[model samples]
Target: MLLALLALAAWRAWVWWEAREPADHAPAADVRIEALNDRISALRGDLRAQAQRIQQADATNRVLRDELLGMGQRAALIEDSIARWSDPDRHGAQALRLDEAELLLAMGQQRLLIAGDLDGARRAYTLAGGVLSGVDDPAFLSLRQVLVQERAALDELGDDPRVRALARLQAFTSELDRPTDAVPVASAPADASWWRRAFSTVFDIQPRHRSLAVRPADRGDAMAGLQLELTLARAAAERRDVEAWRTALTRADAWLQRLWAPSPELQGRRDALAALAALPLSPELATLGSTLEQLRQLRSVRQEP
Candidate 1:
């Protein structure tokens, strides 16, 4: 019974030791848990700071993206300005060509209307067409067609009227320069009486119906007058003065009639003069300056803002 009582006391002592050991470890566990809690708080703070830094970086990225876009737009604008400054007259050559074409067209109209130079006017029109053809713009393409039609109109005129008139005048002048045949005088027979021969030589008798012969001095003066009239007609033709040309030709015809006896050759010369007077000095072309007008309109439109 004493041994059993000693065992019971030992068991109670062991139980008391176990319970005191737990109480001794409790403070260390509290210290470790507090340390862990502090570490978790520090981690949470770091996480929040990292999230704030990410938000700030996103805002900075957005600002940088907008700035980059603005910079790109500015760069594009600057490039365009540089290009404009570098080549101020990008269409200078074309403008010069258009000017040349306009000048040529105006020259053609003046040549045809004022100088009666059909060949010169035709050549000017052709050169204008060539200049217009060199233009690269499609807007002026119709001008080329108009120019072509003008050229065709010139072609339809055939030979130059001034040239024809001048040629005819030249031929007539050459004919006038030729020596005219003198009238043959009848002589008395070889076997006639001396008195009859003497009378024939002393007194020349002609048919009453025969016209009076012109003296050499009068013939020369008349020829000069006719030549002056012919020259006036030619000048009028060159100047494309229809009224002046007709008046001069009419005066020349009158002079011709007064100077020369009525004959086949004389009539032919009169007919030629009449024909030259009838020839047109300046032919009317409906579409002569249409191309130039159209080109000017196109230029004006292009120049507008």
Candidate 2:
């Protein structure tokens, strides 16, 4: 369109020059035509320069578009790699390390809070310490401290007089299998000849020097009394009644001493009971509940997105 317009303007200039040309001012008309041609040439050059610039700009845009696509592909690859690294099933290095810690924490919580297994809980806490040792993130610092505090609490429980006495007393109950004052009669010796055994049995006779062993008609009453004492001790321990527990232990000890012969194990148990009874019975530890709750809260917050 610009070229067409330039052509039209040139035609009009030529007609005007022809009309004014009366064989005079021929040189001036030629000069005006040359000037117009030069202006048209300059205008054409400017249009070409603009077109080249536009082409260069389009090429640059394509390069930029391709770069963006390559970048998108690279970004997708990176995202996939990250997902694989963090996936729980994959158990990548970091994931496995963290999972061990979490599992230990969960186990500890389950044992201490639900099952009331102090030994199991302590083991879990110890395992957690090993797992968490490698973790340096500030986010887990509180959890680590809580675990330490919990382990310490368990240690304190181990030292608690009431708990110790209860455990020992419970063990002692199983050891009371021997009836203190009771003895079993020996069976008669077998006779070499059937006739001789028959004759001895028929006469209900033995050697004149052989002594008869005495057997109780029934020892149910004695067994019942012992069982009752043991039950009372266990119940007292469960109730955390220090006085009742002591009384029950004392009665049971006296009953055993009266009926049974003293043995090494029995002596050891008595000594342990005496030592435990001497120490002041500690009240239930309230710190564990609050510590566990704090740990649970921390775990939940850390799990949040």
Candidate 3:
């Protein structure tokens, strides 16, 4: 019974000590709780800052990705351009240049041969040469040399014979249209005798073999014939018919002899007509179509399977 009572008293004392220890540590517990709350608040602030940093990094990654996409597109475009320029078939800008050059060459030949336009032909050839010069291919280098030779040949030609002939004909026509001065006939003196004057008026003698003066009515017919012959000559010259041009000019000379009294001016005009008839309508060109033909040949060879 004594031992039981002592054990009870000890248990009571332990319970009381435990209760007093909690009261003594209450202020320290409050301080530790406040410190933990402050730490938690600071941790929350750090988490928010880290989240903002992550968002900023994501935005920067998006911007970098967009820039990379634009760079990739530009790179693709550059590659396509390189592929187009390096094509071997010549179906790109080079082919277009060649086609233009060929067209200009043909135009130049036609201008020279058909139209007798030397200046126009030269201009076309010059433009064609300039176009051909842009070609970087070594195979066409000889063509450019041939073109230069042709241009030099044109330069050597000086002026077109047809143009000179036409100018001479126009001058002849202008002279023909001018009024001829009346030649003063030999007459007796002003104080001559009445009988001499009456005889001179009654019997006027002119040489038969000399050029018979055309009557006013016949003058119109002669003028028309002369004009017709001149027109024929012009047409023949335009047609590049050497034989016909000479024949028409010969007929024109015959009409001129019939229409006009022989004078220095008339003789000079006849000489000009003869000179015009002798001029060549088409000047000989050895290397006329050489460049065009060579270009065509080169193109054909390239196009072959």
Clashing pairs in 1: none
Task: Return the number of clashes found in candidate 2.
Answer: 2
* Model 2 pairs whose backbones collide: 180-259, 180-260
lDDT digits (tens) for residues 207-297 of candidate 3: 6885644576566677778889888988887788889989999998887776665656567779988988888888668889898999999
Worst 10 residues of 1 by lDDT: 178-187
Worst 10 residues of 3 by lDDT: 179-188
Comparing 2 with 3 on TM-score, the higher-scoring candidate is 3
- Candidate 2, 186-300: lDDT as tens digits: 2334754676565653444434553322244234444556579778877776666768867876776655443433445546767765764564444345565444466456555
Q: Global lDDT of each model? A: 0.81, 0.65, 0.83
Supply every candidate's count of residue pairs whose N, Cα or C atoms clash at under 3 angstroms.
0, 2, 0
Stronger candidate by lDDT (1 vs 2): 1
Instruction: For candidate 2, give the lDDT of residue 271.
Output: 76
Of 1 and 3, the candidate ranking higher by lDDT: 3
lDDT of 2: 0.65
Candidate 1 C-alpha lDDT tens digits along 1-305: 99999999999999999999989999999999999999999999999999999999999999999999999999998987776555423347887899899999999988887776788998999899889888888878888988898899899988777777788888878878865444324467789889879897566675576543467676667778889998998888778788999999899888777666565666888998898888877777787778778878887776643
The per-residue C-alpha lDDT of model 1 at residue 10 equals 100
lDDT of 1 at 94: 81
